[model samples]
Target: MSPPRVLIVDDNLMNLELVSFLLQAADIDVSAASNADAALRAIAEVAPDLILMDIQLPDIDGLTLTRQIKADPRTRATPVVALTAYAMKGDEARMLEAGCDGYIAKPIDVTSFASRVKAYLARRAASSSS
Candidate 1:
């Protein structure tokens, strides 16, 4: 079987690169987009197994994009995770309410980032099979 695929949407070049490199090292196929428009296009083209969305995009924010992805029948089944710096009170609750399947805080821990991402993918697989 092919390696799992992940799409990361973040306007910050460094964040995007770091996450991409980490996932790649973990043997994931990574696709990235720097903005909402490009992210939408990548989603359609990549059919990513999972999405790591940065909450503050240059265009639409990540929560709004997550809602859009969840609303669409073609993409609803794919898991969307909020990857953001917003760790204040209610931030995670808000993201979950908006439709994110999971959450990952920003300034990610390089040591555990890949495993955490894989955990989400594994959850998706288990849920899909059931």
Candidate 2:
């Protein structure tokens, strides 16, 4: 099987590049969008196995984007994990409520980021099968 394709959406150039580097090193297919408009476009162009979304974006926030992605029939089944530095009370629940499949707090644990991404991909595969 081909490696799972993932989309990483964030406004920070450094964060975006770092995440891309991490995923690519793990042999995962990775794509990125720096803002909501670009992200929506990318989603329409090719459906990703999972999305790593930064909650605080320059345009629409990640939560709103997650809801929009979930609402679209073509992309509704795609899993989204909010990748954010906003580690606050109730953040995870809020992201879930916004239609995120999972949450990964940032600054991401560099040592475990790849493993976490792998875990989410595994979950997506399992869930899609059954």
Candidate 3:
């Protein structure tokens, strides 16, 4: 089977590199975008299986971008996992409300990031198959 494609969107180059490296190490095909505009463009081109989106972007916020992506029929079903530094009360719920499939706080645990991503991909695959 082909490796799942993942789009990692973050304003921080370091964060983008880190997430891309981790996902690549797990044998996933990763595309990195430094801003919302690039992210949207990449999504249109690559049609990634999943998106690791950072909340704070230079142009548009991740929540708004998530809503936009989900609102479009073509990309609506693609799972989006919010990657944020904000781990305060209700943040996760807010992200979910914005249409994120899952939430991962920043200062990511590289050891378990791949596993968490895989878990979501597995569920997505199962659901699609069914």
Candidate 4:
């Protein structure tokens, strides 16, 4: 089987570089988008195993983009995890309602970020096949 592929959509260059580097270190294929429009285009080009969506995007927010992604049949089964700093109450629930498969708070824990991503990918794979 091939290594899992991930799409990370974040406007901050720092966050994008960090996340992509970490995922690549784990042998995962990584793609990126700096804004919502780019993210949508990226999804149409390739169906990734998982998506790391930054909630505060430049154009359409990550929550809105995630909903669009889930609504589209071609990308519905791909797991999306909200990567946000909004750890406030109800934020996670809101992201979930918007169609995120998981949540990862910002200022990510470098040591565990890759593992958490892997967990979500595994979860998505299991759910789809079962």
Candidate 5:
């Protein structure tokens, strides 16, 4: 089977690079976008299996975009994970409410980041198969 494709949507250049580098090192396909518009375009072009979204986007917020994705029949089944610095109380719940399938806090632990992403993909595959 082919490697899973992931789209990381974040306004920060460094964050995008770090996540992409880490995932790519694990032999995953990584695509990135700096803002919501680019992210939407990337989504259409990449047809990513998963999306890692940053809440504090320059354009539309990630949660709103997630809502849009969930509302769309074509993209609704693809898992969307919130990857943000918002670790406050109820933040994860709020993200989940907005349609995120998972949540990962920001300033990610580099050592375990790849494994965590792979776990999400594995879980998604398992769930879809069953």
Candidate 6:
């Protein structure tokens, strides 16, 4: 079987590179976009198995993008995990409300990030197989 594909959407180059590197090390295929528009296009072309999206983007809000992706029948079933620096109260709840399947905070721990992502992906795979 082919490695799972992950779409990462972040405007910050450093964050994007860090997460992309970590995920890639885990043996997953990654496609990145620096903005929401490009992200949407990448999603359409790649049809990734999962998406790790930043809540703050240059053009559209991450929550808005998540909602749009979830609303579309073509991408609705794809899993999305929200990645944000927002540590404010209720931020997790807000991300959940936006339709993300999971959430990860920014300033990610490179060591554990891949494991966390793997856990989610494994869970998703098991659920889908069931």
Question: Which one is best on lDDT?
Answer: 1
Task: List residue ranges in candidate 5 displaced over 4 A.
Answer: none
lDDT of each: 0.95, 0.92, 0.93, 0.93, 0.94, 0.91
Model 2 misplaced regions, further than 4 Å: none
Q: For candidate 6, lDDT tens digit of each residue in 8-87?
A: 99999999899989998899999999898899899999999899999999999999999999999999988999998896
Q: Give TM per candidate.
A: 0.98, 0.96, 0.97, 0.97, 0.97, 0.96
Clash count per candidate = 0, 0, 0, 0, 0, 0
lDDT of 2 by residue, 67-119 (tens): 99999999999999999777799888899999998889888888999999999
| Candidate 3 Cα misplacement greater than 4 A, ranges | none
- All models, RMSD in angstroms: 0.6, 0.8, 0.7, 0.8, 0.7, 0.9
Residues 14-87, candidate 1: write the lDDT tens digits: 99999999999999999999998999999999999999999999888999999999999999999999998998
| Residue 110's lDDT in candidate 4 | 98
Top-down lDDT ranking: 1, 5, 4, 3, 2, 6
How far off is residue 68 in model 6, in Å?
0.1
In terms of lDDT, the poorest run of 10 residues in model 5 is: 119-128
- Cα distance off (Å), candidate 6, residue 24: 1.1
Residues 1-130, candidate 3: write the lDDT tens digits.
9999999989898898888888889999999898878999999999999999999998989999999999999999999999999989999899999999989998999999999999988988998899
lDDT of 5: 0.94
Which residue runs does candidate 4 get wrong by more than 4 Å?
none
Q: Any idea how many clashes model 2 has?
A: 0
Global fold similarity of model 6 (TM-score): 0.96
